[model samples]
Target: MIEVQGLTKQYRSVRAVDDLSFEVKPGKVTGFLGPNGAGKSTTMRMIVGLDEPTAGSALIHGTPYSKLKNPLRTIGCLLDAKAVHPNRSAAAHLKWMAQSNGIATSRVKEVLELVGLSDVAKKKAGGFSLGMGQRLGLASALLGDPEILILDEPVNGLDPEGIRWVRSLVRALAAEGRSVLISSHLLSEMALTADHLVVIGRGKLIADQPTYEFVKEHSASNVLVRTDFVPEFSQALENENVEFTSTHDEEGREQLLIRDQTTDYVGNLAYSVGVPLTELTLKRASLEDAFMDLTSDSVQYHAEALPGEDSDAS
Candidate 1:
């Protein structure tokens, strides 16, 4: 398990990670989510002791990472896949790491096979592709068979098959009772892989909840209804305090947005009011939509219109 309590990191006058606190338990995959420049990398660095926290602490299995004996044996992390020496072969890289920490050379080959890099273990890492580099990094992290795994953008440049492989590997690690904390900007991918989510914005914690609970609370699952009786449907919806948005249909019918709670209620209301319903479709917000709505204001960059496309120029 990993626990971050009141963690804060400051570089000069700017705070990169505010007082953030959260826990990543074993047997589950927890996704760390945030927009760009939201202190995610800084926070991960602090957790692994690469960057010291200005205040508070991060603990792996109840012990501070800095205080751990043979820290890599307790908590394996892949903060940067490109941190390896380019000239060294993947096998040689792991060999040096194992020798430095007194781990057997046999473990190096074990992890290489585990990460599916056994075929090119002797190839120089500089010539490897991004996906191959990521696999090598993962193999190094698993070298010690640690209890916890922390990965930052592990699938950043991976192809579809490589992405699937990483996802399955992380899930399998958690299933074996190891703690896994993965940070990514892809909400849809997280929705498919993570059981819980920790969201941050501007270095502050925005949400820490189960994946299902977060979506259920923040995403609106509404149904769209279209009918010809505009006046009657509008009156009925208003009387029932149902929140809705209106648009005109091609046939001049009224289109109504009905919240989940009022889906059946509105259908009954339309029938009682003698209004014929032409269409009713349920629309549930996806993880991507929920993430956008939550972090819209926290986005660091906004796209502007092209030079010829102005509001008044058109």
Candidate 2:
């Protein structure tokens, strides 16, 4: 298990991570989510003792990373896939890491097969594709068969098959009672893989909860309805105190967006008002939508488009 308390990091005059506190428990995949400059990488660096924290502490199994005996065997990390030497073969890289940490050389081949990199183990890492490099990095991290795995963008350049493989691997590792903490910008992927989430914005914690609970609390639920009688529908909805917005369809029929109600309630209201409903459905917001809503203001870059502007105008 990993426990972070009052973690803070500052570079020059700017704060990168601010008073962050959270815990990653065993037997679960905890996703670390944030925008581009939200200090997620900084926090991960601090956890592994790659970067020093200005205040607070990050402990792995109740010991600081620098003070841990056999640190690599306790906490394995893939902070940067490109941190390896370009001239070395994948096997040579893992062999040296195993030697440095007194791990068995046979573990290198084991991790290679585990990550599906055995076929390319003899080839120089410089010639490998980004996806292949990621696999090699993962192989190195698993060399010690550590109890904790901290990966940053592990699936960034992987193809669909590779992505699925990583997801399954993470899940399988956690099922063995290992703690897995993954940092990624892919909300859809994280939603599928992570059991819990820790979201931060501008170096501050915005949410820390289960994946389902986070979505439920931050996303808005709405009802969608389609009808031909636009005037009657509006009047009925207004009378029932249902706030709605209308948009015309290709067939000139009206589609309403109803707020503060469920689809069943809207359907019953339409039935009571003698209006035939073509469609009545509930629209539950997705994790991507929730992420955008939560971090919209904290985004470092914003795209600008004027009203009625063409795509090429900007």
Candidate 3:
């Protein structure tokens, strides 16, 4: 298990990580989530000893990262897939890492096969595609056959198949009683891969809970209603003090997105008020929608449309 207690990092006046505390239990995948500049990478760096924490501690199996005699055998990480030498072959790269960490050279081949890079084992790291590079990085992480794995953006450039592979691999690893802490912005994939989440914002802990629980707490499911007597239904909703937003469908039909009310309630209300209802549906909050809502204010970076992104009809 990985435990971070009051992990804090300060760089001059800016606090990169606040007094954050959370535990990644064994046999589960804990997703680390935050917006850009939210101090997620900084916290991960501190956890693995890449950066010094101003205060608090990070422990793996009750021991600090620096205190581990055989660090690789205890923890494996892929914080930066591109940190390897560009000139070296994938095999050569893993071989050197294994040598440095006292891992067997035979284990390097095993990991290469595990990550499906055995076919391109001889290719230079620089020539590999982003997906291939990510695979190679994963190979290095598994070199030690550690019980703990920490991966950041493991599927950054992966295809659909590769993403599925990674998801299955992580779940299988956790099933074997290993601890997995993954950090990624791919909410849909993260929702499928991780059993739990550790959400941070502005360097502070925002949420730490199970996947569905977090969504249930941070997002609400709404009811969508469509009616032909739009003004009549609108007046009825207003009379009943029901909150709803109006939008137009592709066919120019008016639609009402009703919040804090169930479809049955809205449908019955329309029926009682003689409002001809064309449709009524429930729209549950997805993991992506919940993530956007929870971290909306925590987002520090915003960008406008790029060149040619907005084309004028005129």
Candidate with the greatest TM-score versus the true structure: 2
Residue lDDT tens for model 1, 269-307: 888878888887778777776777787777676667578
Error of 2 at 217 (Å): 1.0
TM-score of each: 0.88, 0.94, 0.91
In candidate 1, which residue ranges exceed 4 Å CA deviation?
Answer: 227-232, 247-254, 260-263, 274-278, 305-314
Worst 10 residues of 3 by lDDT: 305-314
Model 3 C-alpha lDDT per residue in residues 218-273, reported as the tens digit of each score: 98888988877888988888998888899878888779998878888998898898
Query: What lDDT score goes with residue 183 in model 3?
Result: 92
Say which prediction, candidate 1 or candidate 3, comes out ahead on lDDT: 3
Q: Which is the better candidate, 2 or 3, if ranked by TM-score?
A: 2
